[model samples]
Target: MNPLNLPFDSDAMLEGLRPWIECESPTWDAGAVSRMMALAARDLADAGAEVETIPGTGGFGDSLRASFPHPDRGRPGILVSGHMDTVHPVGTLEKLPFRVEDRLAYGPGIMDMKGGNYVMLEAMRQILRAGLQTPLPVTFLFTPDEEVGTPATRGLIEDAARGQRAVLVPEPASADGGAVIGRYAIARFELLTEGRPSHAGWALKDGRSAIAAMARKILEIEAMTTEDCTFSVGVIHAGQWVNCVSSECRAEVLSMAKTQADLDRGVAAMEALQGEADGVAFTVTRGVTRPVWEPGPGTMQLYDLAKGLAADIGFQLGCGSAGGGSDGNFTGAMGVPTLDSIGVRGKGLHTLTEHIEIDSLAERARLAAGLLMNIR
Candidate 1:
């Protein structure tokens, strides 16, 4: 039975989300992100939650954990997880702007997660208002650095998952309103090439072009993409002068693995490519790593439960896979049951066109509230 039938206010949810979206909490801007977290913490507190603040990597903003105790003491419950950071920069709002048109709320971070966060907050409020008795305690973990792979809050998430029944990640749902089941294991890499520099016009033969070597390595790494693994050279930096032979070059490569074993094998292959370029020494430095959330029994169980809840709430639920990673990857990798993309219905994540279906705010809140009160 849907406890929150006609109880959620979609207009109120969007109004509440306005200040948060206007806050502009880019991951790199620590102070800005922290401010955003504070606002959310206050809202959670007002909604009968006790918010705990954990200082994050000094300048990259802090994390928040909000717990609703109520009467469920011995029973374990859900860890509602998400990130406050958006890929958009501080001034992005001036261009993209926040507005409602044709039932879509357009803005930076609106689709990627701000709308989802609002849905979560509203759901909890509805659950409390409905006086629903849940056998489990609901815990909310908001990280400031998930856009960068949760480097600052990975341990925090895993620790919060301890003895919990499940982790619910409210990343934006598919534009078609599908829930996320499995995600590609993700890794970041910085590949650097070192070579001797010489004047391009005078002694081209004497110089070993680091830029050329980096280009070749980028191709080799990009060629590794297949049915199970994806490699992308997202960024490359080399050379200052057009005349001088570039001596130092760097490339930022992102790898997505369909399986953990595939991730390992891909890394080994990339490592082997080091020093393969003539006269260029290669160095590979790994950044953040998130394991694949393979669909296990627990995952499918959660999916089925969600589908049942959706039907009960007067809607049907669909499940899908994601190429990106989030805190869901952390808990899913830890073998704890995790489900994601269970947020506002939206599309164009991390882009200027990012927006969410305004109507889904109420629907998502009802669905999430139902899951919270029912899922074991």
Candidate 2:
């Protein structure tokens, strides 16, 4: 019953990841992402996985779920999570070019997660080929728009994962090859300010500058942060001309929090700051892109079980946390024991230099296959 000693074909896993990275699935574009998911579903079917599609919730693209229902007794179903979309656009792949040099496969979306997707699929293929069935069922849920937000797919992810015993999110293997058990909540907000405009030199005091108001608000917001919570005013736009007092200005703020209390405190502080500025009118639109992937009561139990399985196989399983969010965040927030970063090792995600380590691919496939065999 040792899962680690199970056979794995590293070349098969790498071959699966190759064609996926060559395809560009951008977040904002629906057509490309849709095509990618359809292709993946076909491949998974070819590998013996039964596939289903949750119709898009009026979003740009759809979310797909693949499953290998088990016929064994006393086993629960485990959900595997990954995102199908990338941060790159249509022609970015050809422009930047997808190239494999030595042990590295470099291309758009290779690391951020097309590579991770392959790791999951190949693991399942190996398990099926090995004629090993877990005590429970195994399912794969892939979503689009994870780079921007799971706006249309968050609810679907939660619904699909509600009854699952555990979730494995193959986002990316950690920078140090560890798995992530926790991730910070991500929130983005836009603050727009309006004020009266007048000639700066001709009647300086007669006009109120919206840019000045926004500057003061930014300072106040930055001062409200502590160790557990952080906020940044990343983009700001104000003023049409140097001689004229700015009538309107806007700034986009990105916030990250480690816990629910921290997120609530940050939200309250932002509201207060927005209300404090009386001279300038303001409008704020805040979006909760992803909630912190907090570990629930039975989370550590699953982690321990996975570690035991890893030890039985031949590799070691280490758990850690990530500052960024993934589709795992949506499932974890819905009270699932979601374990993330169970994917291939890749570096330089979301940049033109993105690459996946060839050596890491096979190891990841082995890890995922071993985990699948042990999940009960």
Candidate 3:
């Protein structure tokens, strides 16, 4: 079934998508995420999907699995994977409320993912409404924690992808409307500095300021950025009183590498970092990591299929490696054919100006629906 022949009203899709964007499911807010999951569950159930709710662990919100029945239900089939979390906080709605301006639908998480999720759901609904079924069984996995990395759901994502025919990730499309065939390796680090505190007014020379040491370390870390790898310090906290030298400081670091070898060297360098001055102690703790996923023949084949489908729908779809990581990293690294970032076309992700091209509502949905019907 060619989904393009079916009626897809962009305005109606925008309205259907408004509630999802308005829900505000930030990763840190478990209750808000749960509410968003509930909304999705209801929609999937209404569309004739067998929905399963996985209780969240480690204080994250619940994940969801919605399956569409087919003759090949028991076999490995398509996995439509994405996240329900956003980086924006709870009160962001007051600042960036849902609105359509000049053919762009603006809201927190609208372009990053909610728009893509809604489009996929609408595609499924349209297929079912037309009395059609995909060649293979379809399963949708919605995760609750992705903005801070999939620390809570990595195992679940891998388990779901195991033995699947393919994994499709509807992360935000690239700036030029390209899909992701490969993703860079990513590692997170937590740094801490400890020093001796003394009165800033009288005993300044006796004080060893942790903040000063951390500032130097931050510069050193950022200076490590090269063509192969990049480092950034995104968070920092220190000092409690103005009259006393800081005794402790902490920061979060993120590093991205084009290859595993480069990332390994970067990790080793980070672990070997030392304090900038005497009497200050520095420490680095490794956190979540995403292994690099280089495009394989299987992934290339999937991209070829998607590219052809896009051409039939009157758009030229491009494919390449992207910087940020997604659940596709797990599946693609495991050698499963994976396609990432086949979502809405838009810009300003992770900011108050986040939004999607209103016209992409129908265009991308057609692309998604085509993949569902054509992928065996």
lDDT of every model, 2 decimals = 0.86, 0.79, 0.92
Candidate 3: list runs displaced more than 4 Å.
none
Residue-wise lDDT of candidate 3 within 20-115, one digit each (tens)? 999999999999999999999999999889999999998999999999878888689999999999999999999999988999989999998999
Q: Which stretches of candidate 1 lie over 4 Å from their true place?
A: 73-75, 200-205, 241-243
Q: Tens digits of per-residue lDDT for model 1 on 1-376? A: 3565837878888999999999999999999999999999999999889999988784679899898866775367788888999999999999999999999989999988988888888888877766766668888989998888787778888998877788888988865688988888999999999998999999999999999988888888999899888999988999999999999998898899888789999899888887645788999999889888876788789889888888887788899778888788888878888889989988888889988888899888988887787777
In model 2, where do residues sit more than 4 Å from their true spots?
A: 1-12, 72-76, 196-216, 235-249, 276-279, 312-315
- Model 2's alpha-carbon lDDT is 0.79
Candidates' RMSD to native: 2.0, 3.3, 1.2
Q: What is the lDDT, from 0 to 100, of the residue 117 in candidate 1?
A: 80
* Backbone clash total, candidate 1: 0
Rank order by lDDT, top first? Answer: 3, 1, 2
Backbone clash count, each prediction separately: 0, 4, 0
Report how far off residue 126 is in candidate 3 (Å): 0.8
